[model samples]
Target chain A: MIRIKVRPFFQLKEILKEKELTIELTPDSTVLDAIEELTKRLSPSFKDAVIDKNSGKVRSYYRVLLGGRDLHQLDDLNTKLCDGDIISFFPPVAGGNRAT
Target chain B: MSGWAGRILLVDLSSGKIEVEVLSPDLKLKYLGGRGINSRLLYEGIKAGIDPLGPENLLIFGTGPLSGTLAPASRFTVTAKSPLTGILGDANCGGGFSAELKWAGYDHIVFKGAASKPVYLWIFDDQVEIRDASHLWGKTVPETEIMLKQELGDSEIQFAAIGPAGENQVGLACIIGSNYRGAARTGMGAVMGAKKLKAIAVRGTKGVKVEKPKEFFLLIEELCEKIRNSPIYPRLSVYGTPGLTTLLNERGYCSVRNLQQSGGFEEIDKIDHEALMPFFVKSKSCVGCIIHCGHFFEIKEGPYAGEKGGGIEFGAIGPFGTHCGISYAPAIFKMANLCNQYGVDVLGFSTILGFAMEWYQRGIITLDDLDGIPLEWGNYEAAIKIFYKMVKREGFGGLLGEGAVRAAAKIGRGAENYITHSKGLEWGHADIRAFKGYALNQATATRGADHLRGIPGGELLGIPPEEAQKKFGTAEAALPTSYNKARMVLHYQNLCTLADALEICKFNTEIIGQGIGIEEMGRLLETATGVAMSKETLLEVAERIYNVERAFLVREGIRRKDDAVMGKQGQEAVASGPFKGERLDPDKFNQMLDEYYQLRGWDKKTGIPTRKTLEELGLNDIAAELDNL
Candidate 1:
């Protein structure tokens, strides 16, 4: 099994009741597999927050990044997860002066 | 024609004269008012080589055509020659001021020449008066507003005022209005000070009349419904911009300790959205904005307990909380209030103060320079003291009041190495090394190092690369790498320009993933003015306005060379945290810049739009003027 750090930020932290989490994933597991496993462990609200009900799409405000790159940028759900990988879940961000 | 008030109020302060001119309908169709019209007016009014604070400089406030209507967060623009960058300067602020100005039966207000004595402009519908403001000159923004309201005896009147920061001609001074809202950048307030003007107050009973009131109301209802149902509405109404705090740190994109490190603030937990939750009392919004992103906070417990204010957004918090190495959320909130009251741009204020603190830590500056103040990190006391001094332009604060660039030069003690600015304007928020597009965005930005003008937030916000590619026609945009990401910047820049021209808040529209887009803009225009505007035409107008702004800067000698960061942003790698070794790639930046220039139909070497490109955009006159340059 490969271990990944699953960190939830902003409002997600309030929902998770934890700032960071250690998720155990089977080898060769894709990001989709990791997400499903991670969400299954959380409350239903957290699960709903990760994925939209009507569209079955990940909500735009919830960002899942592997290492520093968003998982969606790299092979999407098909992207392979590696040991010691950090997957972060970020909430909606809008800034007047912030560049990101 | 229907959306416009069809009048421009001209106040010649030097002559104590007020005249009203008809706004040409053709000009309205082409420019669409707000920043677009303001830039056109500034370009026509001001000549190069004149002092930005001289009597020759023209200060203008242009409201969008849809400003007084039932449009979400419709705002106005303040345009002037910048005392900060000494170039084309404009800033936008939200609240009822723009709509009130619009209801006064004018699309724009132009202030010409310097007043011989302190004065304030008061407008009651079509009637204008230049009243003596000697009694109000040195008051804080809050004080001025209270005094003006009491004098006028009308609490309903909206106002824009400058405080001691502007009175002292601080280069980073901002014009405060709508109580905590401000045209807060590039020292627009200093221009008002230079003109010996103190404030502008207006009260109007006239209503905004559109070409098709029924159709406009239909469009407005539909938009309000869409905004209410949007996925982001709940999060915005709840967390506001504080939502971005932990998210930026999680991505290792947060600027910490003057960007010496990327993320990993020691007290990150103390200032996250959750920490600020206890202080959040209620939701607030501007004019017609339904998102209610503004949160009214009351600090119930802490050193700042009982302190209350509004408009505590990313601009204030990013620099106040993250960059300054401070995590006492209340202090951050309190400091932001002080900035609002003092009439200074929070981003610039916090940055310069942070710069001094970092310099003190690095031994570049010492206790002697700061009059025995330790200047320690996270020391909210010193930061507060400095902010007070900055507004009053006293001693050490006076030296730093000219902004980071001039201050660095004046210090001459290797302090320049610590300062981060482009064209004298301090870079706001992000550590450019961590974000891929920041270097190019900073360099090419007209007002200098501004991120809001063009943002690729969709890439960072988890929009899948394939999805973004399908929408924006760019694969590299979803990633911050220099591989053809310039197109993404251009795309957002154009859309944001559309937002500014239309006076829609970017928070409810573009930056928060999606709300108002080109289609919505076109529909709004058509419904309000009975004009058939396709998405393509709207985008063309946006592009035209952007180029006109660029041309304005070009006239003042801004070229490819001026479009650059201080080099430290790209040259020095991040010292610690998740992005320990990240730095901007020079080669990739140049390649992407070449692509951007080519895409813009600009001369690659000079970065100026070609004559043919100008003519194609229906700007032959601008082309002729640039030819003379």
Candidate 2:
């Protein structure tokens, strides 16, 4: 079993309401797998907001984070999950000016 | 200038004569307005092969058809042959000035010859006057803005003026507006100085008219809604551009320590957008914009406590923070404030200073050159001190005032090796290794190394895989892939040039993403200008405008090799972070460039638009003119 922790930022938190969520998933579960499980448990409106019903795919700009890094840089939707891995769902939001 | 005041005002300071002439209809139709119109006029009016900084050079301020209208972010463009790049240069500025210029009923103002003394232009609707500006000449940007507002007795009137640095004609000096916003690249302010023009003050309540008001309003409302709901809107609204620190750090695109390495700032947390928001007092808008990305800040409980300044964007933050190795938030804010007050481009200032620090470290520049001030990385106080001296053009700062390219050339002993720049302009915050498309775009941008020239929209938007694959012929092609990025860049360049000519902000196009294409843009233009247009026609006009500007560059002696990025720098891998060991492949870049030029109907070998291509684009006159050159 793997424990996936989710967090959100800016307006994404407003949509999520809850600061954090923890769910059990099968070992080696991908981000897409966890999102599917989470959406099934969520309200219809929340599910609609998270995934496009027409295509049954995650929102194009919706960001899925594995730990602190963006999943887009990793294996994307197929990125494997591990035990006690922290995940974050960031809706498409622009970044402010800051020095790297 | 019809919908305009029907005249281009030319002020010759050396001759002390102000001449106004009506703009030809063909010029207006072909060039449209803003930077495009300005470049066309400059090419036609100015003698070819003239020195950019001499009395022969002309400095122009152009307002587009959408400026002073209900269009969002309809700003002004400052255009000239740059003393810095020795090529075509244009910089856009957002504030109230451009709108005011339109209200005063002139599409563009052209200044020719040089003045024996400093002078400022005052325009009140139909009335125009040039007054001696000996008193206003030496003032800093903030002080000058305040004094001009007070002298004019109307806070509502807009003013674009230069500071002491501009008066000195420093190559990187920028013409600042309302103390913060500025037309801040390619040394446009120096051109203003060469003309001996101190400032331009405008006031007029005469509003602009749209061909179809109802349709224009409806379209504007829909565009506004789209912009508001965009995923990118919140970040821009909350943090301006300072929010990119984390992303740039993670992606290894941040140009740290003059591109010596990428990523890892010790005080990154302190300078991030979230940390700075608590100091934000209000949000400000440009012209008719509702987005109001400009933030006003008031610092509390720090060394620089009680300091009130406008929000610093990504370009300012990155150079001040990563390039200078200064990580503390307060220090960065202070440095930004100093640059703002002095009326210099922050990116130019910081990049030049970064080179000086590197040179000093390499024993190329000594303590004697720095006037006993130890040039060290992360030394915030020292950095601020240098900024003060540079603005004043005093001591060691005098040499530094010439900008990185000139300063490096003067300081021999491999000093140029440390200067990371393209066409005399330093690269902004977005490092090229992580985003090669931007790198190539910067190299060939009409303005030197400008990111706004070709904004990477699709990559930033995270386009859907199937749609991306269909459009690009491969999914990877849409995802910042080096393959075929040049074609994508050319598309963006045309789109952006069209946007600039229309005087709309890049944010409008980017936020709308794939939802709004050239078709939507054509509809907006038709409704605004009362002229029928199709997407293809508008794009053709954009292509023609681009070719005309390129022809001007070619006449100015710009070659195909000039478009290529500097060696080693272009191929060097990012040293650290998420994209460590990533470098742009030269072969792929060249291949992409070849395809891009071929698509544009340009000569594959020289990268110049062929005579046939120019004739097809309805630029037969330009083609003939290029032949003579």
Candidate 3:
């Protein structure tokens, strides 16, 4: 098992009811798998805040970062997570949109 | 003329002469409205080498055809040659005032020359008057609105007024609309003050008429639905723009301590939107806007107990709190309120404040030079005191009020090295050293260093490479560090121009691309005006507007040399954050700029639109003028 920390900011933090959370997942779990675990542990509203219900993927405007690098710039949702890794979720602000 | 009020009001304040002219159809089809028409008018109205504060300058207020209709977040643009930059100057403002002006049966109002005494223009339907405003002079923004409402005997009358900052002709002055919204950049208020114009109160009863009311209404419904369903809607509606603070800070884009460090402010959370929620009263919305991204808040229990206002965007809190090293949320709010009351541009004020603090720290400016204000970082009390004196143009604030560039010139002790600016205007507090697209945007923005000119959001949004390629023609455009940002910046510049011309809120357009794209904008325009417009034609018009503004800047003597981000942004690497040790590569920046000019069909060498490009855009006269020059 690998332990990874999930940090939510802005509306996501409010929805998750915690500024930061640590959860255990299977070794080599992807960012998406961690997100699934978070949704199950926290509220389903966490999925609503960070994931697009239609695409079953992270919403484009919403941001998910692995460590300090963007998920897209790294390996996106399929990027493997290791123990002690940090994943941060940020809801969209006034900046432009991302394609779904 | 169905969507348009179809009249332009020309007022010569020096002679107190007012003339109403019929709106030209050709001009409407080309310029569209708002900033587009205003730019064309300003280009034709002023002469080269004329002082911006002199009687020769022109001040124009314009609203788009969609302004008074069901268009979402309809706004206005005030345009004049900047007393601050001495080039193309304009600012977009949202509030109740634009709709009121549109309902008064006018598309544009042009004011020229200076008044002999303090005066305010009053417009009510068909009646217009230039009234003596000696009694209203030297009033704060809210005070001016209150007095005007009392005198007009109409609580619904909307006003655009300047405060003591403008009255004193401070370079940071801005025109305040409805006491909350401000045409905040390029010193539009200083221009008004230079003309001795105190305020403009407008009211109208005639409603806007659309060509195809049913079609327009249906399109409005579709657009509103899109905006509501957008991912940006909920959070933006809740926190307004201040919500971006933490995200930007985390990304290393938010400058801290005048770019000494990027996003290393330990007290960032203390000033983010969540911190301000306890003081929030209610959500505020401009006319015809569904987002309602503004909020009224009061500092009920602190030293700023009685302080309350609206329209405090990211520009205010981010700059005052993080950039100036002030962590106290209430102090930021108090300074924001003070800026609104005094009709000062918060971005300009905070930029200069950050510059001054850094200068003092570097020993470039002494405590004696600051008039014993200490002028230290995180000193909100001293900052507040300096701000008050800035509005009054007193003591050390007198030099600071002249703007950072001029102040640096006056000091002349290598103070210029500490400034981050473009075209003599201080940059809005974002660390552009790490983001090449944003760097190019700020460097080339016609109205000095401004992010709103072309905010490159793809990099920060983490757009997928495939999607970025499909949209911007290159996957590299999605990365903030890549040199292929020219295409993205050009597209965004056109998008922003379209939003400004259409007088729609950028939140529905460039700011959140999901809300309204080019196709929807074209449909809205066609349905409202009965003009046959396609997405291609809309893009053309947007491009035309941008070129016109560029031509205006070029005529004002801007060249490739002037189009640059200077000071630390150009010289030094960002000190800390995820993108720490990153700085703009000169070669990459030049390559991006070259590509941007090439994409715009401008001369890459001179950064001017080629005659062929101008002529193709139906700006033959401008092309001829440039050729003569």
Candidate 4:
């Protein structure tokens, strides 16, 4: 089993600061699997932030990061997770005069 | 003025005389309109080393060839001897003001001497009048705009007016336009105040004549289509430039607390584009622009709820939000409104305030200096109160009103060390460690740390991520590593200069399309003026114009050493996020500068244009002058 740490950003942080769960996953489990497992443990409001109820899918513009690199650069939702990896989920949000 | 208005309108407020005279075509082509034109004209007209606040300094408004035409984002240029930079000063603003001036059939408006009494310039087509403006002089920008519109009985008439800051001739005063847009940097409003011109009310119904209308229209449509489809369009259209905040914070480029830190704010969620969108009531567009990037926000909840204003632009958001450690959007919105109403540059004001906060924390400044108001980071109420004091020029705020650079100089303990700035102007939000190319761009920018001068196309140009990483090593290198920046900055500067000359918006070129490159711009120029020109030939003109401006700066004693970055940029590492512990590599930066100077035919060591280089660019006269110097 692999242990993964996940941090929520933007709106996701507002919703799920609690639960703050460290989940044990299968060694080759993808980010999608981890997100699904976390949602099952979350309150209804927290679940609503990550997934669209009507589409039953992660909302477009929802950013998922694996080891600080965006998941879109990885295997989208299918990239396999590793032990002690940090994943972050952020909503579609941007501010600042300068782009990071 | 061969391809221009063929005349300059000179208004002597002291004598109330309006004189019209032809501006030589040689001068027009040499300067290439907008700030360049204004610089040359003012350099010739104003005596050297005159006080910036004195009536002897001339304040000129200039428009470019593309301004009144169907070309995009054609706006106006405000030029004066700067109270901020103490050198050649020019700030370009977007709105309909420049186009209106063009429609009034003038290429430029030059204000000379000082009015014996408060007055405003009212230009309706060919009719010009200097009317009593005593009642309007103290009004806010919005109040001035509304009152002028009501008085003129023309809802579409555009006005560029100063608020109390300008009336008081505050060193950082900006000339506000369209209620929110401004010629905001270099204290041009103080120049306006010195000239005793409260506002300029302009309306022109005369349509701009294009030499080849059909071709111009087709080209404009094609360009607009390209911009509309570009990936940048969606972000700019939806959230304006503020959309970059998340990207910057995530990448660790955000300048937090006056360049001391970087990272995404815990409260960043509250200030992102998505969060701010619900407050956006409507959109505003510049002259002949389809892409309305101007955001008008209505505050729904907060101490300043129900307050309406335009802009909370990227610069305002940084100093008012992340830099000061306040992430509340409504508070930023209120701060923006206050700056607008008071006629101050929001970026300049907020940066100075942020510096003060840092100083207070370090014990360089006490609460006594702040008039008993605690100078804490994220103190929004204190920030708001200070804006009023700055406008009124009261208490310690009077000293702070002089802006960060001068204020630091006056308080000379360790306060100067905390003031992070380059060339007297405060740094914009782009932290150089994360974006080295922008560092170079800001370092060399004519207006001192202006981002628009050269946008570092490698980062902005949309390369595939893997390829970009390999080519640039990091996002920071993307700008400096690109071989095209020498040509890119030169090209964009020319296009932007032309935009200012034509009095159009830069967004028309920058945001609406794949940008009007030298070739396209040459075509547009030819089509508009019936002056046949090749891309290479037009580029030569651009080069000549650039050299002339360089000569002016050189005459003002600006050198390679003056272009160095300030604060802990070279010494300190970015403290957080992806680029933590990384600072700009000096050797790489020097190499880039060497390459840039070599490309411009400048002396590599001094960064001055070589006589050979100047002569090659058709600046023989300027070269001769430099030799004399």
Candidate 5:
């Protein structure tokens, strides 16, 4: 088993019961597998925000980064998980900055 | 001049004269509109070393060609010699006032010289009047608007007014419009008040027309739909900017306790968007703004319940709430209302109060210094009392009204140490030390320490490297720690400059990045103005406008040294959190700045636009003026 940490940010943080978590997962588990496991542990909003219910593809605005690099850069959802890995999810967010 | 009225209303308050002059086409084409024209006029009309609060300073309201059109989020630019920063003061506010001003048949309204007594400019269609406003003087923004509306017998008359803060010539006072919206930075209201002008009330029934109505409608519809379908569109409609409180808080980049830590205090939970949900009334929007990000807040079920009003923008939360350790969103909401009503810039007031609280905690200040009112952290009542004192310019407030720089100078017991400012302007919210590109943006910003001048949101936030790479050359620009900021800063500054020149909101372009692209903007221009300009041409205009602003400051004796970095930004590390041990490296920053100056085609030594660069940009006259300097 490999232990990895996950952090949900912004709008998703408000919904997720566990914000930052370190959990043991099966060795060589792909990012998709980890996301699926975490999805079960998270609220419905996370499911709706993270995954396209029909396509199963990450939404355009959604970004999942591992070790300060995007998961898409490594291997999309198939990137192999490693021990002591850090995964961060940035949900869709916006702020009006000096527009007025 | 289908997109423009081709007219400028010049009001000489000293002579009580108003003249309608034709706007030169060459000036409009060369400078663009809105901020571009305003800055050019200020550069040419006002002299160097003039007192910012004196009658010699000119106050201008400039609207872009697209402002009164169906273009989404089009705003107006307000320009004057800033009393706070002692340089070219420019601010943009979004609302219907700008559009109405355009429809009233003018491109710019230039106010020069001080009135012999208190007066207000009244504009209705082609008729403009200087009316006695002695009775309306010394009133809050809302009160002044109400009085003007009642007297005019027109509920639709839009107003831009000042309050006691401006009447006292407080350097941080702002000119408020359509109630909550304000041209808030750099003491524009103080300039207005110094002119003995209480307000400007405009009502226009003439209506404006665009070049291609059908094409314009289609483009606007497409842009509006883009705004509606954006990922955060619904969120904006529901929570507005207050929704961002939780977002910034979670990022470990919250301007917590005035840069003490990432997220201010342990009770920071009480200051998030959820904290304000209980007090939420509804979301508000300006005229023609599809992304309605202004939430109407009311204090309900709290100590201040039943106090209903608007304006608790995201920026206000940092200063009035967490930055000062005040977690009560209700009281903070009320404070925002007070600021809006009193026509004060929340940025300056909050900085002063936060500085005072920090000094108090450090044992450098006490109740004895404040006439028995202790300025402890989270002391909302004490803050409110001080705010009122500032508006009235009473006792200690008299000194504080001079803003953080002057006040810190007067209370010279190492008080300036607490101020994280550059160019005598207070740094709002974001700790630039945590965000490197933002540090460069703030440091090099012509308007002093400000973020909107060039928003590095895409790079600071976690945008995919591929996405960021497409615009900024390399993905390295995406990191908050990377020193590859010149290109990113230049790109966004050009975008922001275009937005300001066209008087469009930056949210669709800078904040979200995908909502409105350069191609769409280019198309919008073609369809509206029949100008047939490309994105590159627009960027050229933006660059020229930037140079003019630089030359204006250069004439005022600003240089590389005056383009000073904020205090402690590059010197010290943050106490803790993700940004811990992260401060700007002096050597890296110097190299980055040198590269930035090279990219801007400015003199690296003095940070001034070179004569060759200015000449290439079709600003021959401005180039000659700077050459003379």
Candidate 6:
């Protein structure tokens, strides 16, 4: 099994109640697999925060980046993960607040 | 005419004259209102080679048709030739002041010439007066507003005031309105100080008339609902813009220690958005806004105990906290409060502070230069002291008050190589090296290195590939590192122009990945103003406004060379973090510029609008003038 470091930021950090954590996954696991692992270990609200309850798909505004590269640029959620990869979950940074 | 207040108040301070001019319906149709009309007026009123801080410059305050209505986040724009950048300068502002100004039965207030003595304008529903403000001089923004309200005997009066920084005519001085809102870029307040204008107190009970009130109300409700339902709403409503701090740091996009190292702040957790949550008093909002993404906070138990303020956003924390190497949240909050009270632009002030720290580090400046203050990184005390000196124009701070680009020039020790600026204006908090779209946007924005003008917010927000393809014509447009973002930038620029013209917040638009798009805005405009504006026609008008601002820049002799992100900030690769070793590619940047200019229908070589392009936009007069140039 490969181990990936999963970190939460912004509201996700508050929801997860943890700054950073390590999740164990299979060698051929994709980001979706890692996310599933997170849902199993983390709180149910954490799953709700990242995925839409209605669609069961990751929220559009929620960003899961691998080593600073956006999932959209890589492979959406299907990109395979490697051992010791750093995965970070970021809450939406745009769309709300007045532009400063 | 239905949506417009139909009057423009012109104040000639030199003669103590206030004249009312009927706003032409054609002008309103072409430029809409707010920044769009303000830029057009500035372009026509101010001639070339005039001192920006002299009596010759025009200071305009403008609100749009939707302002003061139930529209979400209606704002205003203050426009003047920048004393800092010496080009087209305007800053969009939020708060209740714009709504108040609109409700005062005037869409625009244009200040001309200069007053021989200190004065402030009082507009109480058409009873306009220029009163002596000698007593109010040298006061902070909060003090001015409080004194004005007491003097007027009306606590409901909304005010826009400048503090000691503007009184001293500091290059980066800003105008503070409605308690904490700022018209904070490009030294508009310096122009106000030169005019000897202290404050503008407005109180209005007049109502704005809409062409189809029912349809407008329905449309606004729909838009508000969309904003409330956006997935980002819950987080933003709580954390506000400070939420971007940790995200930016994680992406290696945050500027740390004057950008010496990207994402290099080891104490990121100590000062991220969550760090500020414990001080949060409640959520605040602008007039009629639904999202309410403003955090009102108080440092109850810290070094900054009893310090309370609002409107502290990424601009404050990024500059003072990360860029200056200070991890203390209370100190950053105090700095933000100080900037608000002193009428200083936090981005500009902190950028110069970081530059000074870097200079001190490299031995370019000495203790004597800093007047014995230890100019070291993370020294909030020294930063505060230097800030006061800059506002007061005392000692070395006086030299730095000339702004980063000009100060570096005066220093003359290859100091210019350390700071980052475009067209003499300093950049915002975001490090543009990692994001190609933002880099290009900063290079091409008319008002110098401004992210609000056009920074591809969809890409930053991580919109889906299919959605990005549908909107920007390619999935690559959604990727931050993609060079094929010319179309995306152009699209956002037009949208931003439209949002400014409509006087609605861009947060409620597609630029921020939700809320209304051009189609809905066009419908709202048509419904509110009885104007027949389809999306296509509205976009043409947006293009027209952008071209007018561009023509103004072109008239001022700004070409492709002037529109650049100069210095090591743009050239050197990021020193640390997830996106390490990333620097802006000059060739890719130039290619994007070529594509952008072609898309804008301008000369790619000189970056000037062609006579044909100008004429086609119904700007034949400007076209004729450019022909002479």
Candidate closest to the true structure, highest TM-score: 6
TM-score of 1: 0.95
CA RMSD of all predictions = 3.1, 3.7, 3.1, 5.7, 3.4, 2.5
Q: Please tell me the TM-score of chain B in candidate 4 relative to the true structure's chain B.
A: 0.93
Chain B TM-score, one value per candidate, order as shown: 0.97, 0.95, 0.99, 0.93, 0.98, 0.98
Model 2, residue B13: C-alpha shift (Å): 2.6
Better of 3 and 4 by lDDT: 3
Best by DockQ: 6
Alpha carbon lDDT of each predicted model: 0.80, 0.74, 0.86, 0.72, 0.79, 0.85
Backbone steric clashes in candidate 1, count: 0
Rank by TM-score (best first): 6, 3, 1, 5, 2, 4
lDDT of 1 by residue, B1-629 (tens): 67888899999989988999999976788888899888888988988878999999999998887888898746888999998888889899988899998888988999999998889999999789999999998898888999999999999989998988888888889998884788998999999999999999998778788888888888888887777666566666677777677667766677788877777676878887777777877766788887777777898876888899888786666777778888888999998888888788888888888888878998887888887777788899988887787788887887778988888888877788777777667873577665666567777777888877876667555566666688768766666643567777777788778888878888767565656787888887777767778888888888889889889888989888677677357467877765678776777677878888887888988989899889999999999999998
Task: Compose the digit string of candidate 2's lDDT tens values, residues B4-101.
Answer: 44557777767777777776677667767887888887887776678888988888888887788877746888888887778887788888888888
Q: TM-score for all predictions?
A: 0.95, 0.91, 0.95, 0.86, 0.93, 0.96
Task: Name the weakest run of 10 consecutive residues (lDDT summed) in model 6 chain B.
Answer: B427-436
Off by over 4 Å in 6: A10-12, A43-57, A91-100
lDDT, model 3: 0.86
Tell how far residue A63 is off in model 4, in angstroms.
9.7
Kindly indicate the candidate among 1 and 3 with the higher lDDT. 3
DockQ of 3: 0.28
Candidate 1 vs candidate 2: the TM-score winner is: 1
- Candidate 4 stretches with Cα past 4 Å from truth are A1-100, B1-4, B460-462, B465-504, B510-515
Q: What share of the reference contacts is kept in model 2?
A: 0.23
Could you tell me which residue pairs clash in candidate 1? none
